[model samples]
Target: MMNVTRGRTPFLLVFLACTGLLAYAYYAQFQLGLEPCPLCILQRLGFMLMGLFALLGAIHGPKAWGRWVYGVPILLGAGWGMTTGARHVWLQNLPADQVPDCGPGMYFMLEYDFPLMDILREAFTGAGECAEVDWSFLGLSMPMWTLIWYVGLAVFILWALVVNSRGSRPLEQ
Candidate 1:
């Protein structure tokens, strides 16, 4: 059996990580002048959802089944982020001629009163802007990094779930 902390440290850590990621994203957008496409915006929302769920779970500190209630949304948010990240990566890898045409910006769509579903459909289909690799680290683009982060966070959540499932007792006195 695994020994787990009764306190909400693990969940708190996850929340903090998500917050840090979002903070960097804003920094990249504002300071670095990286314009986020619609898909990027969606990915940000995914991170926000994950962080929100993690914060709530940490605050509630529920055991057993309650963890599942929180875990599901966190996983869902990760999955959403992964999906968008994958799409963005795919777009980036597409040949120049094969890339999708650039579409209207999300703000423009909203201001022009485009239907909600149409906006989502266009966003998911991806635009030329999403394919541009304006930033990279260790040869991996931002979307690739985000994909990795989502996978890592999901795995961490799973491990925390298993460890914390053992008992209600704190791992340390």
Candidate 2:
């Protein structure tokens, strides 16, 4: 309906913005010389998945049943991003002595070090490198900012999806 179509615009804008952020993250790594640890990589995956779901939902602009279907993936992706971002923040706040020892780089884990499931487990649990606070803005570290962004996006998308799905029904008398 008209409501779903119009609502899709925000989804498109938000998804595109997420893509831009991911682009900046890569730029920070490759151009600015900031190294991404395994947990950072996991967070990146979450963003990518979230963007993918958002793109699909925006394009489909599905009615009722399909709308709910699209919402599930979007919500799941946001939840994933929130979880990873929170984990990263937790690792960053740990005392130096409490930080876990560094694991092999992501390359080794994928190519030789661990099985797929183990690699994911290691990435989420975070090795020593995940605790480094090499980047900050306005006193908040990158992970803190990432967590904030994920929370905001999750809330907005959820609200938008609910409103759109309900359409413009009249109140019961």
Candidate 3:
């Protein structure tokens, strides 16, 4: 039993570290004058809530009912992320003028190597439009990757729930 308990510690550590790194990224954007888009904001909220749930579950020590407690947050976060990703995908298909200006200039994407001419182009680009599905890395759009992330999180959380449930079973069973 103690060995099982000790094993959980590493899981908890990774969870905290991942969540903390994401939080720091969000904080950096805000501090560096890079406003987050609507999807980014929503994802951040989900991550924060997930972090809280994990923190609570760690403190509670994974009792039977505590499985339910931790499980809910991860599921909720996944739903939130899914919605954001869908919205982003929709925006990528809309006409230029119809897109929503979720935030300020494209400077938030300075890391993208947008040239002076490109900046001028985006000055006319409007907010997030359906026409511009330009952002991609590893051949996946930001929204597409976010969708994968949310689904992956959901799977992992469910796995944790299952593991915790099995651990609580009686030896006779």
Candidate 4:
């Protein structure tokens, strides 16, 4: 062992937790029975990118550029999350009789690889209807949470990035 101390563990833990969440979200959609919309896909991308940045920072040590790398995904993920949340809000605001079609009709995503493209295709085109909120937990709908999480994740990522950046600068003795 390299004799890693307690101080370093928290950062590692946070990285692992984020990575796990991203992995689980993707698995839930692809393996289980959830299909994310375009915005959902964007969120996933954000998570994945963030995870990658964190992993690099953790393994190689938080370097000069590492903070910016991490921040990029965090901001992107946050933006995507907002879009998803807004989409849901739009749907919620619509009248029962006037709900627009939110169904995925993909002739684009299908142009990629088989397994993922299939999954992507299903994600957009297969979800019965986009406007209909199919599920909710506690008092909030999934999209609502997605929105909250997006804003929250952005803040968190920024915090993490700042810490990493500060840590990167050597202190004057």
Candidate 5:
């Protein structure tokens, strides 16, 4: 239906906005010189995947099975973003004494032949660097802000998917 078709444009816009946010993150990293922790990098990766999937979904506007297929990556990326954001939030709230010691850089872990599982475990468990509060707004840190964004995006995608699916059903008189 026309309503479902209209939803596709908003999907592209929302994803473009997300892409802009990631651009700001990069600006903070390069221009402002805020080094991203491992968890931050992981969150960025999730956003990247979400942005890619959303862009494709917008361009293709695939129907039925195709939309469901697109939904898979979007959900996965949003889930990944939420998981990493939650971990970062937990680390930030920990007491100084409870914070884990800093580990080697991500490059070190990957380059040193560490097992993929070990790398993921260490990243998720976090370290001293991951707990730092380098940026904040309205008293919430970057991770907190990102968590909020991921939640909103996930909700929007779900709502749009449901609307589109319903459009395919025959209406009762």
Candidate 6:
């Protein structure tokens, strides 16, 4: 039991980290008045997915093969976020004239009953609004920071997996 609990530490940490990030995102949106663009919303979803998987993994605390099951989804979530972040960063770096024209807000598109594919296409294509670097820390934009976090979290999970692979001894009765 102790060994199992010990193995869950990493998952719990990941979950907590995700929670903090999400909370800060909300703070940025409401308090800081930084509206999230379409790509930002998608990035948030990815973080949510990763956090959900990490929470489940911690609660389950399964040994051996079970780790792989949870780890895969977490990695997928991270990859999803990383890809979105990369796209956002690329958009931000584009020359002024090259930036795509701003599109309708996600809410507006949904309210108007736009096709799902169309919504996705517009979001991925990245509007002029998405290219603006409104928020930054230490010279890195929000998307750049998100990309760094995704990569860092993925690496942490991978390290945890490797460490857990070394079989633990069963507790004595």
User: How would you encode candidate 4's per-residue C-alpha lDDT over 80-100 as one tens digit per residue?
Assistant: 557656765566666877665
Model 6 / residue 56 / CA error / Å: 0.5
Estimate every model's Cα lDDT from 0 to 1.
Answer: 0.87, 0.79, 0.61, 0.57, 0.83, 0.89
Model 3, backbone clash pairs (residues 3+ apart or across chains), number: 3
Candidate 5's displacement at residue 16, Å, is 0.6
Residue by residue across 110-163, what tens digits does model 1's lDDT show? 899999999989998756788889999999999999999999999988877876
Q: Give the TM-score comparing model 2 with the true structure, all chains together.
A: 0.88
lDDT head-to-head 2 vs 5, winner: 5
Model 3 lDDT per residue over 75-161, tens place = 787787777666666777677677766434554645577676655444334446423554566987656766776777667767667
> What C-alpha RMSD separates each model from the true structure?
3.1, 3.3, 9.1, 6.4, 3.2, 3.8
What is the alpha-carbon lDDT for the whole of candidate 3?
0.61
Those runs of model 4 whose alpha carbons end farther than 4 Å from true positions after fitting are 1-14, 23-32, 63-65, 102-104, 107-128, 163-173
Task: Give one clash count per candidate, in the order shown.
Answer: 0, 0, 3, 2, 0, 0
Best by lDDT: 6
How does residue 90 of candidate 5 score in lDDT? 95
- Which wins on TM-score, candidate 2 or candidate 4? 2
- The predicted structure with the larger TM-score, 2 or 6, is 6
Q: Candidate 4: what lDDT?
A: 0.57
Pull out the clashing pairs in model 5: none
lDDT of 3 at 51: 67
- The full ranking of all candidates by lDDT, starting with the best, is 6, 1, 5, 2, 3, 4
Clashes of 4: 2
